[model samples]
Every structure is written in C-alpha cells, then in structure tokens.
Target: MRKQHIKSHPVASLYVENQSWLRGWLYRKVGCTHLAADLVQDTFERLLKRESYGDVEKSGAYLKTTARNLVIDHWRRKALEAAYMEALHIQGEAYHPSPEEQHMHLDLLNRIDQVVQRLPVQTRQVFLRVQLEGWGYAKVAESLGISVSTVKRHLKAALLECCFYCE
Candidate 1:
C-alpha cells in the first residue's frame, strides 16, 4: 500500500482555525445564534468566489465588519416585515365592523321606520313614496295627483316631524 501526502491551502487552514472564534463573536454581537452561524458560513462561501479582496491585511476585521453589516440588513428587513404585519392586522380589523356598531345602525333604521309610521297618512305616504321608494318630486306629485309644490311641502313637514320624533 502506498501513502500519499496532501498539501493544505493557507486560506482553508485560516478558515478552520478562526471559525469557532468567529461564530462566538458573531453570536455575541448579533444576539442571535442562528444568524451568526449563517453569516459565518456565508462569509466563507463568499471568500471562495471573491477575487477583489486582494491579500487583505486584516482578514479578521474584514469578517467582523461584514458580519455586522449583514446583521444590520437582517434587522432592517425584520422591522419592515413587522410593520407590514401590523398594517394588515389593522386593515383586517376594519374589514369586519364591530357587532355593537352593526346593532346601533339597525337600531337607527328601526327608529326612523317607527317615526315614519307615526306620521299622518298623507305625510307617511308622501315620505315613503319620495324617500323610501326613491321617486323624484314630479313622479311623486303625479302618483299622488298633487302639484310639485304640494309634494315639496309634505316632504318638508315629514322631515321636520321625523327630526322632532327622533330627538
């Protein structure tokens, strides 16, 4: 059996020696174990492909500074996502009106109905025909066989009565 000797690359040796220290430093600085591990792995991966680092004088400082910038970017993205979620939560809350608000709206409509019922027959008819049925003044006047002025007078009186009763 023949034994073969392999040469170790200087860059790979330095990476192995410093990885543990780098991981610990990154965890303390970023306050996140998982992110620290990820950044350290990414830095080494980038070192393999990066051609412009050009025999860096202080590789440790370069790694630490790069890790810090990565952490800052991560925090910025987290903040933006948090704000987006808060906006969505507010919009979802608004999409469904509160039960109390729905009840209040129903109560107001019922009160209006009761007030219209209490009016005189002609006034109730005029109010319902014009307001509830959405008929124009001329159409209501023709249907009731009254002049437009008479229809307007009835509507005004009905509105006043409604306001008085509602209060």
Candidate 2:
C-alpha cells in the first residue's frame, strides 16, 4: 500500500507493538544499532506492501524471517560492491580517469571495435589473438591452423585499418 494507507494498516499496529523488539533482535543479529534500526524500518516498509499478513499465524516469526532476508541481501550487496572496489584498486592510476580522458578513451575503443567488426572473420580473429590478447604471431597461427605468413598479412591489414582511423 501507499504511505497514507500505511498509517491505517493492520501492519501499522503490528509495527507499533513490535518495533522495539524487532529492532533489538536485529541489533543482536547484525551487531549494530544503526543498521538494525534501518533494517527494522525496511522490514516494516516491506510489511506495509504485503497483500496478506492476516493468514500469518506468528507475526513475530514472519517479521524475523523478512528482516533476516533483508540482512542477508544487505551483506551480499556490500560484498559485491567491495569486490568491485577492490578490482578498481588493483587497477591503480587507471581507476580514476579524468572525464575528458575517459570520453576520449571510450571513443577510441569504440572506433577500434567498429574497425575490428568490419574486418574479415579470420583477420579479426588473428588481430584479436595477437594484438588484444598479447599472443605471439606463431602461437596464433598454430592455434588457427594457418601459416605464420597468413597471420602476419591479416595483422598488417588490421593495423593499417586501425591506423587509417588514428590519423
């Protein structure tokens, strides 16, 4: 239901009755009063939107289950964000590109991608393996079952096309 409807909701009465208990339970689970308070609020907000709590025989159990799920979701989101930040930290100076530099870099990458897409399939594969993936020409040729000279020819064509855009 909407915010206005929440004031008159049966869940509102439930919230008023059990809010302190719920918050204390959350605090014990999460070990932080501030986060527990926030989760209690979130739990009540979720309860307000439920179509039926009338069938819920044990309201406290239902509230605890919902709050527990919220806590789990909160932890998962925190872990994922931490992993992303850690990856950025590992990139060091590249993590914080200036807006203009970022724009230019993205434009260059897009142009390069477009050029690669226009190449013949074998040429694109050879170029990606040798240039983008840092594979040796000999290794690429071996992997593709082509002669080294054919690999060089495709890479030269790809580089020339890339240079045409660069100029």
Candidate 2 RMSD computed on C-alpha atoms after optimal superposition onto the true structure: 13.0
Residue pairs with backbone overlap in model 2: none
Per-residue lDDT tens digits for candidate 1, residues 9-103, read 44466577778998998899788899889989887766666765555434677777766776765665566556645655688865654667645
Best by TM-score: 2
Model 1 scores worst on lDDT over the 10 consecutive residues at 1-10
Q: List runs of model 1 lying over 4 Å from the truth.
A: 1-10, 93-167
Q: For each candidate, what is the lDDT?
A: 0.74, 0.83
lDDT winner: 2
Q: What would you estimate as the lDDT of candidate 1?
A: 0.74
The superposed Cα distance between candidate 2 and the true structure at residue 108, in angstroms, equals 24
Return the TM-score for candidate 1, rounded to 2 decimals. Answer: 0.46
Count of backbone clashes, every candidate in sequence: 0, 0
